[model samples]
Target: MSPTATTPPVLTSVQIPCCVCGTMILPNAANQCPTCLAQEFNLTERLQRGPAGQKHIVIHQCRNCRRFARTPTRYEFAEHESPELLSICLKHIPALNQHDLQLVDASWIWTEPHCMRLKVRLTVRTELLSVVVQQRVMVELHVQFQMCPECNRDFTNRTWHALVQVRQVRNDSKKGLAALEMALAKNKTIRQHVLKVDTKKNGFDFYFLSNTHAQTFTNFLQRVAAMRIQRTTKMVSADNHSNTANMKTTFMAQMVPLCRDDLVLIHRKAAGSKLAGSLAIVTKVSSTIQFVGASPKRTHVSDSMMELSADQYYKTEKHYQMLQAGHRLVRFVVLDVELCDEQAPSGQLYEGPHSGVEKYALADVTVARESDFGVNDEMFACVTHLGHWIAAGDVVLGYDLVNSVGTDDWEMQEQLHGGFTLPDVVLVKKAPRNKETAAVGVDEQEGQKRMTKKRERRKRYKEGRKQKELEETAGRMGFFDDINEEQVDEEGEDVDADFEAELANDPELAAELLNLERDLAQLDDGDVVAEGEDNQLVEEDNQDS
Candidate 1:
């Protein structure tokens, strides 16, 4: 019976029903067919983000600086929405396991400035479905234009916790404004801390969001200018329930009146201090005024060690113009310099500010006005006016001296004792002779008028002056003699004058003629060796060879 039954029973493949749809399916197929599973499975069932409702993706942004609130930090307007927008969209969409959903694409379309349409394409994978599902979703977001807390406070204009009033004692608003701008540019943190800047006639007002920031700007000013500060506070608001009050603080900063290069006299109140009673020249203006006193005796006035005031203990005696503005520097050649131990004579002393106190030696230099002749021109200037030592061959600037007003002398003597005299000429900066003169022209017509007067004066002098004056003028114009044919002496015969004129026109031939004249003069002076002596030397040399 077993042998007869050995024929294998007919085995048939049975169709298995899908778990999800109860439809016949192959064994190798997933739990459900693609179509049936797609119909039954929900793509958003596992979405961690809840369905759209009262709770939505809310974005808080600043209206002024355009910063968005991004949980931990406020993102700048320049930041491109990346994981931020993705995380935000996922947070609002109805989803359970966010990992199961993949955002394929997301775009924003501005319906209005404050409103945007957010379109997102999501690829969703479900555990029960064989095929991936893609869903396109859209939402309209109305960006509320309500100001952020900082913006609201900024717009209120009264929200500043601290105010700084910078007052310049000299009422120099330009300098104050320039200094403020420079300070802000130099320090990034200080600029950032500043909330508002208001310009005034003699000072400036700075408003800061925080008291510490206001103090920071004040400290910056203190470090850069000599100033004093006073602080005050007032209660602006109070909360009865919380027992809290808002206090508005103000910082008043007073800047010094003394600026760089100003000469100041110390009063009796300042005499007892290290910087008191001595005359000083301001060299720098910063958190404190810096000065260099008379050399070898009093060198430096320290800011940290002394308290200096513009009005009470100090007096600004005089202000001198810089080398560029006061005088047009002329070309001057130093012909000679005489160094002596004796003090400079009264007639040769520097006359402008510090005169007899600072001693300088005598020097005789030749000065040539820019419109005059070459470096060989002769005009004398003693070294006392220069206030500095000079040596031969050094080209110095010839600055016209300012006349001292005698009426101001009595007042000046009170500040500085001893004889003080203004100079006839001041030797300013030393420079090369060939440099082009920088003519500061205020008006073309005014300059033309001055030139016309100068030409008229020169014409009168040329037509009316005596022979001695003519010789002096001729000597001064030595550089032009080689270039101008008419510059030859008119007293010469016609043939000589003609020859001289031709030579002047031909510079190379004129140079050769001058060389020949020099050789002839050497011969007349017996500078040329005798022919017999030359012959004897030549014979001796020939015998030695």
Candidate 2:
């Protein structure tokens, strides 16, 4: 077959004249050359419609609090490049809200912070007549310095609308107040609403901007510890013309006097009731006080264990007298422990208010005062409930009933009537041991090595404290009602091995401490990287030297 003749296709171009420049160009939706369109068309003016009146915008910011007003009723704190600031800015531009417009890109324009001016560059695209139009729009932000309602109220004399006064009845030990403070620290909702925290001699004073916040804090305290709350309100101001009154509310929360390990002597009047007229030890303190019988005469079956609720305690507080406070416990060294037979009547397990988690065995323990270990050969022998935990050479905290003064009415009755004779020493809990003391039967070299390690750890701890102090000093911009960082640090330092052991033994306290630690970790997360960098730099300098 003969080869087919090759055919070529012809391409054609349609030319049009630009309206402004009078230049020949390809036909487009604008019907103009690129140069002419750039010179004649204004993207910003064309896009301005509806609520987008002009390129200039004004945003209100509080000069005192440094918070931006997102709306008339809402104020927010946002930094540069944050999504919150971007959202707040975008809401003011109504043209961007339209469905036909697409926001291709957005960026911040740098401006001096002192100038109080912000600028944003937005690249937008839209389609029209099968042709795409892209334009860059600049929006100017003018910061109007004005005090928000909250700031204004804060400047006034009556800043806070509610106040909370937390006081403990027996302030000898700060355990109750410390526990409450931990609860407050762990709860972000409570901390944010607290306008001010003032430490007093016996307790804390917390101020709130609103009554609702104060009420929420009061409820939290009730759930944390056993406390009685009394509420009162006073009229701060009255507006006769508007028929409105401003009232300030105050809540007083008094913590129960009883604490864990406390020895309580029940009064005679309440003796007729259940779990009364006898000496008891407080095993746990929460929204209620859990007591276990400490009387030697009471059999294991009749342990006389009971729970005293906050409300009931408050109603009959006078009926209870603290015989020995927890802080008064004396240290004792266990000389020996003779475990009694489980089948014996004296060794039978108590089925009363035991949690069943802790195993206890009946034993006759021989102990002597830790302070009097070498001073005198005085010894004490008693049957204890802590046989599972106590052993020879172990240290414990107990009440020296033999040496204690008989001041309370119950003790006087016991002395006069000869009804029952109390034990010479009643052990409560095992004392935590130090690294040096805990290490038993170590050679001289190992002991010296441990001592050197302990000294190094102490030095590092001191250096850390100094570093923390410097950081606090550098960032010490105090607000009107800011909490004292020093007090918080002191509280944290007070949590030694003894307190940690107590937390481990008590489930409720352990849970609260866990929450406190979690909150503290979150607060310090941002500083971790900076601290690491600082340590790395120090190490590098040391290596070079």
In TM-score terms, which candidate is top? 2
* Clash counts for all predictions: 15, 0
lDDT of 1 by residue, 143-215 (tens): 3344666667656874788999987755211333344444554355666666656555356677888888888
Model 1 / residue 241 / CA error / Å: 1.6
Instruction: Mark the regions of model 1 whose C-alpha exceeds 4 Å error after superposition.
Output: 1-57, 61-67, 71-81, 88-145, 149-159, 171-196, 268-272, 294-545
Instruction: Summarize candidate 2's per-residue lDDT along 1-545 as a digit string, tens digits.
Output: 99999889888897888877888877888887665565455567644432546555677888998888888768899986577887887776677878878999888888887787777788888765445667788777777888888878777853888999988866345567657766655456667777766655467678898888899989988888998999999998999999999999999998897778888777656633355655778888888888766654425523556788888887777778788765456778999886654554342333445745235555678999877866999999977767667778988877888777774345456522246456778887776565333312223354356556545655667656544433432222122223345544552253233444444434455566666657655656756778899999999999999
Error of 2 at 471 (Å): 14
- Model 2 misses residue 292 by how many Å? 1.3
Q: How big is the positional error of residue 46 in model 1, measured in Å on the Cα after superposition? A: 12
| Local distance difference test values of all predictions, in order | 0.49, 0.69
